[model samples]
Target: MTRETLDRQLHHIQDEILLLGSLVEQAMLNAVQSLKNRDRAAAHKIYQADQDINEKRFAIENAILILMATQQPMARDLRMLAAMLEVNTELERMGDYAKGIAKVTQRLGDVEIKIPIQEIEQMASIATSMLHRALGCFISENAMVASQIPAEDDQVDRLYEEIYRQIVHTMIENPDLIDHTNLLLWVAHNLERMADRVTNICERTVFINTGELLEMDTTDDEEELDSE
Candidate 1:
């Protein structure tokens, strides 16, 4: 009920959010490493990291629940708590998406095959940086930076589309590589989704800062950019 208690709760939630961010970064790194070196153990560790994300999500939700029940947070406080809920959910899904990529890596490890890992690594690096920026925007309370996340995600989307085309081409040309190529294609899809979820967190951050949700549309991004 006291201001001190509320501040403490907010601080605790912030810490949880940061920890979630760290888990996300680790997941991306380990997943890419799995693909690069065919490291099954690294993939397994990435999979295991998902548990930490889930636990952090639970902890954040619990904190929010307690704050609402006891602190009676309203107005901006209510907005913050709601955004925190959305942020944690997005982060959880992103973590799962990362695990999905890692799972594909683990599967490829059993077979004696290799695919172009660099494209995926490049995608991962850019997407991870976008996620890192979203995390930074939240911590700095920068609505402008948060709102710009969708534009940053466009890069990842383009890379995903490119990779998808290459994978489909490779599969069509060499039907024997269909299974492996499809696996890599699915991994790119998962990473794209992860980038999307990271963008969602930024939208939530913008909402927290300005009290409005701005949904970004990628459908006409090309035309929109050309006109601009």
Candidate 2:
């Protein structure tokens, strides 16, 4: 295949990845909002939208195979194609996390929130914005902007920490709020994990674009439990 044709295909693949990012962002936002509004229908809608995310993921995988098989790109081009595959995997996981949040929302339908929704909402906001900015970084091949996303991820972690501390304090002091508060904690944990996955995608983009392997804090990394 001609280099021009291969490049065009890469661009198209990148666009599909960005489109998947948009879907994940929308799903996260809608899930959180549905929970806040106690609208199970809206929550289920977010779950239904995940079908599109899955379809787009299949399309991306096909693009990856075609690019790898036909183009036979070397070095940088190959890293980019591989990175796209990795990032899309993370995006699909984010989509699943969104659906998980939506399922929780659906279960809690019409149930008044016992714990505050502000932190998780904030976490979702930061995560969705990071997902968008990370996609922009991918399009522009801007490792700098991609590096900045880890800071936004810090916001998600801080919100998670704050939520955890608050819930612990409330549980110890109030006792009665346990069942309801535990569910909210789980929701916040999922949002926090999703945000961490966004950072992982950003790190992969930085590596793909710049060939620099930079380490960032990952709250979702389960090795910490073993270490502790």
Candidate 3:
């Protein structure tokens, strides 16, 4: 294949990845909103939308595989192709997390409980923003933006901790709310994990630019240090 053709295919892959990101972002936002409004229909819709995200992801991966086999990309170009593959997988998993949140919303449909949702909502917001920024970094091949993206994960972690404590306290005080609160906890956990997946995407950005894979979870490091 000619270099020009390879470049065109790579650009197409980038566009498809961004398209997948947008769909997943919408899924997460809808899931959180559905839980807040107790809107079963909205939650179910997010679940249905995940099917499209999955299909798009498979198509992008197949295109990347074809390029890798036929183009024989070398050095930085090969690193980029590999990063796209990994980022594609991470994006798909992030979509699954969103779907998981939507499922929790469906399960809690009209249960009439007073579980706090603000922190979980905030977590989802930060996660989706991280994903958006990470994708920008991916498209621009900007390692600087990628390096900064993981710091945002720390905010999501703090929100997750707050939500967990609040839910546990509520569950303890009102034993009847245990089941519903547990489901909310699962939703928060899924959002937190999704934020982590965004960090993985950021790592892929750095990998694509610098050809180096770095772990960017400094929040865990600080926690361990404080415990010590």
TM-score per prediction, in order, is: 0.91, 0.89, 0.94
On residues 29-121, what C-alpha lDDT tens digit does candidate 3 reach at each position? 998898888888988898779999999999999999999999899988899899999999988888888889888888887787876777877
Model 1, 67-175: lDDT tens digits are 8999898777888888889888888888887888888878776676556677888889988888888888886778887787878777887788788778878888888
Question: Could you report the Cα RMSD, in angstroms, for every candidate shown?
Answer: 3.3, 2.8, 2.0
Q: Could you say which candidate leads in TM-score?
A: 3
Clashing pairs in 3: none
Write the number of the candidate with greater TM-score, choosing between 2 and 3. Answer: 3
Give the per-residue Cα lDDT of candidate 1 at 78. 85
In model 1, which range of ten residues has the least summed lDDT? Answer: 109-118
The RMSD (Cα, Å) of candidate 2 is: 2.8
Task: Estimate the TM-score for candidate 3.
Answer: 0.94
Once superposed on the true structure, which residue ranges of model 3 sit more than 4 Å away at CA? 221-228
Candidate with maximal lDDT: 3
Task: Give me the runs in candidate 1 sitting further than 4 Å from their true place.
Answer: 110-114, 220-228
What's the candidate order when arranged by decreasing lDDT? Answer: 3, 2, 1
Model 2 over residues 86-172: C-alpha lDDT tens digits? 888989989998888888877765655466688878888888888888889877778877887877777787798898888888778
| Cα lDDT, all candidates | 0.82, 0.83, 0.87
